[model samples]
Target: MQGILTQITALLGVTVGAALIAKFLRQPIIVAYIFAGIVAGPLFLNLVHGEREIFHIFSQLGVILLLFMIGLSLNFNYLRRIGKVAVAGGLAQVIFTGVIGMGILRAMGFAFMPALYLAVAITFSSTIIITKLLSDKKDTDSLYGRHTVGLMLVQDLVAVLLMVFLTAQGGSMTISSSLIRLALGGLVFIVGVTLLARYILPPILRRIADSKEFLFLFAIAWCFALAYAASRFGFSIEIGAVAAGLALGSSTYQPEISARITPLRDFFLIIFFVILGAEMSLAAASTVFLPSVILSLFILIGNPLILYVVYRLMKFSRRNSLMIGLTAAQVSEFGFVLLFIGRELGYVGESEIASFTMVALATIFVSSYLITHNGKIAGAVQNFLAKFSEENHPQREEKPPVYDAWVIGYHRIGWNIVQVLKEKKRSFAVIDFDPTVIEHLTKEGVPAYFLDVSDVGLLSELPLDRARLVISTIPDIQDQVTLLKHVRLHSAHTVIVANAPEAKFMRTLYEAGADYVMTPHLLGGKWIGHMISDGKASRAAFRKLKKEQQEEIRSGMPVQEL
Candidate 1:
């Protein structure tokens, strides 16, 4: 017991030291954790030697918890909203990358099964890493960020399915027979869970939610119970854990449950990454260095190229395509998990595992910087990439009719403004970079232009000078700056309203010649204050307001403005 405690202490100490160094170097803490693992493993200090099994158990728990949290946050409606590009594009990239990756590995003298496993492993991009980086860069709500997230979610679902398929193959039955049995079992489990979630879980959750402690405990219990059941049925505990969370996902307590599990998840995940690192054999890795480097290059370059072609064919702008493609240039955490499974299944050896691990480490390390500085990278190569775009330039062959109002960005806030404009019978044009948004508006017979306000050339094409009012719902400071500069330069008298999420940016926008800068957070607070001051803050009134908002949503009208 003393020895185990000492190992834990040493592991934590090493992790902290490595994390501090990684932070100083401006690298991801994940890189630090893996380094710590290598240091603690037999390759170095050998701190985890006797307690390796314990650490492995902790790592598996981490993965199970992580999948549960993922299921809790998975919103099917969100996937639907992102539309075909995310779904179709995600699947297309995976299939193409897998095929090409397998071919590359085969040519390099790998057998079929190992190459197949490696290929599938490389096809996924790290959701956790990308989400963290996107949040850090404050691009979580950006068009490109949304698309990237949507694509990752789709990939995640595919990974889960693949994991289940692989688990099925682990049995003595033939491939087809195993698959058939698993499918039938999966169908029964899903149906049973869905029925329970819809009818049984909600009421129980609501009752338990009254006591936070009980709710939290029940969530953990449910997760482990389903996980155990899944393992019994020959599926992985990861799938079962995710299924449990999915069952509870529609409950009112999902957010609270997720919050309660996150700290636990983070704590265990450190162990998981460490175990992953500790398992790597540097000697074995050395044998496959050349092939690993080749695969790494393919992931870092070829994966992005595939996405670029996919996005361009979907009519996305060169800049957006570049950003999205660059974001996907790394293999995912699930890739590591997949490789680990392959090792366990005897489909790959230690050298192959080491090869893929090196590829993941290399691609993740480089892609972090690539995604964070994607704007600069895209700007530098914008000219060169523009040549490959379906639209070489943002072109409106015929001049759009002059309008009373021009709405830049057709998302949440802009959508509300469009409703107001329609009600007032104002002539307007919606400007958005997202092809999906533009297509939707065009289909609705709304005057919409597929133009990014950030592009000075695209801004020039729009008749902003003639519009009496120009409102930009885009919260990006650079894009807003570009719009304000153009409007101020060309139409000094036009009223320019801009949106800024942070109050700190309000003064900047105002100074940049914005007549009014709307801070959504502040606006929401002011609205609540108004309700209180007007004696409309009663519970009944609040419920009535909610009802009205829901009705508006149901009727396809925008609710209150952000």
Candidate 2:
């Protein structure tokens, strides 16, 4: 017992110290955790030698919470809106990668079943890493970010179903019976969450949430209950935790809950990654180093190429397609989970698991480097990759209509401005890359196309000179700067309105040549203040306008009450 406690203390001290150092160095913390793991694992100090099970349990919890947040981010309607390009691109990448990975594994002399498992493992992209990187780079609001995230959401949702199917295959049930059982399990899960969310949790949470301590305890209880329920039903605990988050996400309390739990998630996740590293068998890994490196390179190169090919075929501009493709170069954390489970199922031995882990480490490390140096990489390959583009298609010829205004991002703020533009008889059109938003606009007879403004080639295609006014509702300061620079080069006198969520970003946009910047909260207040000062009885009119606008806002939001 004393030894165990000592190990825990040493492990935390080293990891926390390393994490602080990494933070100061402006590097990814995952690298620090892995390094700390190597220092503390069997290969070195051996502080965390035998207590591997505890960390494993915590890691499972991380997976659950991660999946739950993923579910919350998903909007089923987005699939309907993506054009032939995104859908074709995503499907093509999945199929091509899965097949190629399997072939490579088989050629290297692995049996068919393990090869299949490895292939499926390689098909996943790390949603967490991608989200964190995109958010950090302030690229999350770009057209490529939106399209990439939507495609990832589909992959995750499909992965959940695949997990369900795989779990059943490993059970005692026959395939047909297992399918029936899986359907029943999902139905039960949905019903149970609805009952708990609609009837049981809200009132209790309301009272508990009034006290910070109680709210924290209740959240833990909620997470544990769902996890236990999932285990009892022959499902993964990760699936249950995700359901818990999804239920909470459906509530008005979601943002608050997410905020409160983020620190806890961060703390636990460090231990999880450390444990993952500590379990590695260096001697075993070395034997398979050649195979692992070979497979990792395939993932680093082939995966992104598949995405790029599909995007280009779908008619996306070179820049946007490239950006989206870059996000797929790494194997996901889910690949690690799948590899671990492969061991438990007796499909892979310790050496094979070590090989997969090495691949994870290599690809993740290299992918991070690639994403960080994306500008340099893009520039280097820009000319060579252009040869693959189907740029001569007939659809490129039709000229965009002459408009007085052009709006970027048609989801949140853009939607509201579009309504106003219509009311005022302003000749305006919107630029967006999301399939769903574009589809909705098309259905409403608005001139919308799947556009990626980050793509310099696509920007070159737009008739920006004809539009006297431009409004960019995207939140990325860098992308806004790029667009502003191009627009200035094309037409120096065009009036431009853009948005930023923060003062620093707003200032950056203004310096980049924005005529006016819309900080949503500040602008909303100013608009209401003007309405209140308009005339006698303006307060009453303002109240009515608020109700109508609020209703419209709620209706147009991507999130729906589930």
Could you tell me the lDDT of residue 209 within candidate 1?
62
For residues 47-151, what per-residue lDDT tens digits would candidate 1 score against the true structure? 888777898899888877877776675555544667687898899999999999999999999999899888999999987667656755757546787789778
Flag regions of model 1 displaced more than 4 Å: 82-87, 106-117, 126-171, 232-235, 315-320, 332-351, 371-383, 390-562
TM-score of 2: 0.61
The estimated TM-scores of all candidates read: 0.62, 0.61
Instruction: Choose the strongest candidate by TM-score.
Output: 1
Clashing pairs in 1: 126-332
Which lDDT value does model 2 have at 462? 67
Candidate 2 regions exceeding 4 Å error are: 20-25, 69-91, 109-114, 127-171, 191-220, 227-235, 313-317, 333-351, 372-384, 390-562
Model 1 residue 355 CA deviation in Å: 2.5
Worst 10 residues of 2 by lDDT: 391-400
lDDT of 2: 0.72
Clashes found in each candidate (C-alpha, N, C closer than 3 A): 1, 3
